[model samples]
Target: MNLYAIFAIYFLMWVISAFIMLPFGIRTPDETGEVLLKGQADSAPSNFRPGLVMLRATILATILFGLYYANYVQGWVTLDMLPGYSAAQ
Candidate 1:
């Protein structure tokens, strides 16, 4: 695909990866036995590491996007391969 298409796809993949990675390696304030701030929720993470999360997300997204790109290039799967798909028009 073109550069713009690749970038768009990668951006989408990154966002998805970020969400999937959010819950991992997290410790809620209650779990860590830490005193919460006045407005902080009990469920808030004691050590919310945005940098680490982003790093993990980037790695995961890279791998996922690589696989997606490979599939796109190799045509390993296609719309016609779906169980109920009909190409007739």
Candidate 2:
């Protein structure tokens, strides 16, 4: 894929993950032997965290895209480009 396309895809992915996905519920045990659930599961150490999810997705996408593009020279997974105004005219 082209650089811009890859960037835009990652940007969109991040936005979706940050705004669309709901927060996960946290489950933990308190000192009193009771389930002490705090904020979302993304309480910094929670396994399933939503905080900075966009950052994570963007980073993952960028890395994968870079790897794939670097290894593939045939543009197998390249981004598709549409005709411009000049071509239409």
lDDT of each: 0.94, 0.53
* Model 2 agreement with the true structure over 1-89: per-residue lDDT tens digits: 57797678667655665554335343334322454365534333334465556556566666765666565766554334443424334
**lDDT tens digits by residue: candidate 1, 11-88:** 999999999999999999788888889998888888889999999999999999999999999999988888899776
Number of clashing pairs per prediction, in order: 0, 0
Instruction: Report clash pairs, candidate 2.
Output: none
lDDT at 13, model 1: 97
Model 1 deviation from the true structure expressed as Cα RMSD, one decimal place: 1.1
- The estimated TM-scores of all candidates read 0.92, 0.33
lDDT of 1 at 69: 98
Let me know the TM-score candidate 2 reaches against the reference structure.
Answer: 0.33
For every candidate, C-alpha RMSD to the true structure in Å:
1.1, 7.8
Clashes of 1: 0
